[model samples]
Target chain A: MADMIQIEHLKKCFGDLCAVNDLSFRVKEGELFAFLGVNGAGKSTTINIICGQLKKDGGNVKICETDLDKEPDLIKRSLGVVFQGSVLDKDLTVKDNLESRAALYGIHGTKFKERLSELARLLDFEDLLRRPVGKLSGGQKRRIDIARALLHKPKILILDEPTTGLDPQTRTLLWGVVEKLRKQENLTVFLTTHYMEEAADADFVIILDHGKIAAEGTPLTLKNTYTGDFITLYGVSEDDIKKLGKPYERIRDAFRVSVPDTHAATELIIKNPDMFRDYEITKGKMDDVFLAVTGKSIGITGGEQ
Target chain B: MNELFALTKRNTKLYFKDKGMFFSSLITPVILLVLYSTFLKKVYDDSFRSALLAAGADISDSVLNGCVGGQLVSSLLAVSCVTVAFCSNLLMIKDKTSGAIHDLTITPVRFGVLGFSYYLSTLFSTLIVSFCAALVSLLYLAVVGWYLTAADVALLILDVFLLTMFGTALSSCINFFLTTDGQASAVGTIVSAGYGFICGAYMPISNFGNGLKNVLSFLPGTYGTSLLRNHFLRGTFAEMKNQGFPNEVVEAIRESVDCNLEFFGTKVEIGAMYLIICASILLLIGIYITMNIIAGKKRK
Candidate 1:
């Protein structure tokens, strides 16, 4: 895949504090790329710089092979960014807001109408086009925001914490729509989200810590590299597990033993079939991988599926 | 250019759509008119009568009414055009507070086009409301006594247009420093209340002490009010001349109503006043554009 977004030594600073420090990454075309970080970890700053909303101190950024410094307006045409905060005018209806935003992109007449209708249908916000943006619920507004972002038919969609405060059902529905759009449009989705499970579905993930790339890999690869799989025995005593010469911890009523991988877990279970009759094996979660890499808990447990 | 017009149209629509903003811009002038009629009318009448008595000439009530009405209309317009601008230009601050500007800046639209769209919208909205106020003033003038010629009415419109341009440019410059709704409102309130006094709209500049008059002379808005006063009261001045009143008395009426504002000890000519207002508008617009450019460079 061609590199849709290329960042080399991207740096941004505010006074004495460095917001994005020597950050470098690339997102491939038609890839679901996740950028994960805790608060003040430079996620928003990086996204803003890429969207040409902020100036970087030093960097070479290319979007779809267009130099950011030389042709920022040209680069902007390829990017559809959904900011963390609401940008719609409260007094304007959803249709007016979208139409005005579309005008900024030079989308007009039948092209605007067709694009708006397509996004409305795709994002399940067709009914909300005439309602005032301020009157809509959060989920409804989120759908409208997504529709506005897609109105220009941009190739790269940058979602900055797009589902931060949404309900579970709404988040699931939003992700489903995003997945569908990704498939249909061949979109290179650059996402920053707090939900580990959302990042888990990405083709590649980058974990940022204190303005640095702490870790980067596929979801499964990061999990296997940073975290260990677990095997829980319902009736095994701690001493019996100690006798097995494996590290073990006591759960509510089970002995949980950790292993390097699913292969090790299955091997141990098969070797002690009598002791592991009532046992369940689980793979490491993205949450665990995140915790291991950043050494800080995200506090929302995404259990194994 | 099409994008610019689209955004400008949307912005103008947004201004009128907000009930508080739209009504406030219109009501401010009406309120000023009412206050002037209720309290200031007698002050102006008494001053005119005394001027006539001292001159040993008795002007007819019809011509006296025309003169007083001209002062009323000129002061109302001079103040309202500016205050209405402060209200209409709130759309810029609204965009900033709502983060709508963020969405706009990220688009492919150039900053120059975006900025010009905002300026055009402010100019159009302010002009619409100010013209409506001008109509009301004209109606009031018709009711009191119609002394203005077709040329006078035409010149009054030209004055309104020039004042609106100055007000829009001044408001845009001030609003560049404002970001929040509270700040914008506070500034709006201050301008709406304090501007009339500063421009000598609420009272004659001749009534103010010489020290203050000298200070007011430096502001272009002072000249703006003088320009409007010249057009609005020219018909009455000519009437006084026809009624066999002396030039010094006509000049006294001019001085009393701020038609002949003195810069330092030298009296400013009517043509020079227009030049000053035009220059101030250009200066204000230049300042606003420079601020945007500096801010844009900082962002880059």
Candidate 2:
């Protein structure tokens, strides 16, 4: 697949502090790309530069084969960005907000109405057209935000932490809509999220720490490379695990032993069948992989950990 | 061009839909009218009465009351038009704080168009509210005995239009740096309270000391105030002339009521006042456009 977004040595600074330092990444067309980082990890800064909202101190950015510096307007047309905060006018109804934004992209008359209606149905917000954005719930507002981003039929959708404050159920539903759109529209999605589980679903993930990429790969590959499979034993004594342990962590009333893979875990279990009467082997989680690479636990969500 | 109109429409709609902002902008002129009628009416009436009495001109109380009403209305509009502009233009700061500007800028819309939309929006909203204030002033004039000709009314509208342009440009330039609600309101409060006194809107510059008047003379807003004062009180001046009052006495009343302002000891005629106001409007608009262009260049 062709690359939809290509950034080389992207650098941005604020006074003396470096926000995005010599960062480089590529997002291919029709791929779900996740840029994961903790708070203030330069995720929004990078997205702003890509969307032409902020100036880059140094970089070469090409969007859809068009140089960003030379033709930012063309690049902007292909990008639909949902920023971290809600940008809809609080006093205006959802339809009005969407229509106004669509008008900015030169979508009007029958085309605007058709696009809005289609997005309203696709995002399951048909009933919310008349409701003012300020009165909507957080999840409802987020759906409208997504619908607004896709109003112009943008080829690439950039969502900057769209699910940060949403409930788990809402987050799942939001993702369902996004996944459906990606499939139906063949969208190249550039997502920045703090949720490891969300990042785990991406076709490619790049973990950023302190304005630099700590690791980048498919979720499973990242897990296999940075973390190890584990065997959890219930009702196992610490001393008994210590005798056979390569390395182990105590979890409340249970103990988890690290191994190279499921096979190694199975072999360890077989070798010590008497000692491992209540143990089960499990694959490593993406959270563990993120922890291994960034040396900080983003866990399931920023709120959770 | 469509993008500019659409954005401008959105901004104007947002301002009107904001009940607090819309009502606040309208209520300011009414509040000032009430205060002026209550407190400043007697002072202005006494000043006019004393002038006529000193010249032995037997002007009736109705004509004197009409003159006083015109002065109050003109003074109030001079400040209200600009101050309400500072209030109406808060939409720009609100958009900044709410991250709407970021959302808009990321679209295919050109940044220059986006900035121009803001300027146009402020102009439209300010004009609407200022016209409403003018209508209210007209109603008040009816009560006090209308002395204005049809031409005076037309000129009043033109003066209000020019002042609105000045207010929009001046507020847009100043409010560009405002980023938060607190900062915007603070600046709004300061401008609303202090601008009237500085521009000789609340009181005639004739009452002020020479030093302060000289300083006020250099400010463009002083000429804007004088323009409104001229249109508003010209009928009253013509009434004095028709009643057989001598030109010297009429000129004294004109000077007392600030119909003619002096810029550094040079009297500014009505034509010169319009020129100064227009020049100031252009200067302010130029500054605002330059600011937007420089900001755009910085991003590049």
Candidate 2, DockQ score (0 to 1): 0.76
**Residue by residue across B61-136, what tens digits does model 2's lDDT show?**
7778778888899999999889989998888789988889888888888766777788898899889989998999
DockQ of the candidate models in sequence: 0.74, 0.76
Off by over 4 Å in 1: A234-255, A299-305, B208-214, B264-267
lDDT of 1 by residue, B228-265 (tens): 88888888899889989899888877887888888888
For A167-285, candidate 2 gives per-residue lDDT tens digits of 98889888898888889889999998877778888999998877899999999899889988988899878889898858989898898889998778878877988888777777788
Task: Provide all candidates' interface root-mean-square deviations.
Answer: 1.1, 0.9
Please identify model 2 stretches exceeding 4 Å from their true place.
A232-243, A248-255, A269-280, A299-305, B209-211
Clash pairs, candidate 1, are: none
- Chain B TM-score, one value per candidate, order as shown: 0.96, 0.96
| lDDT at B285, model 2 | 85
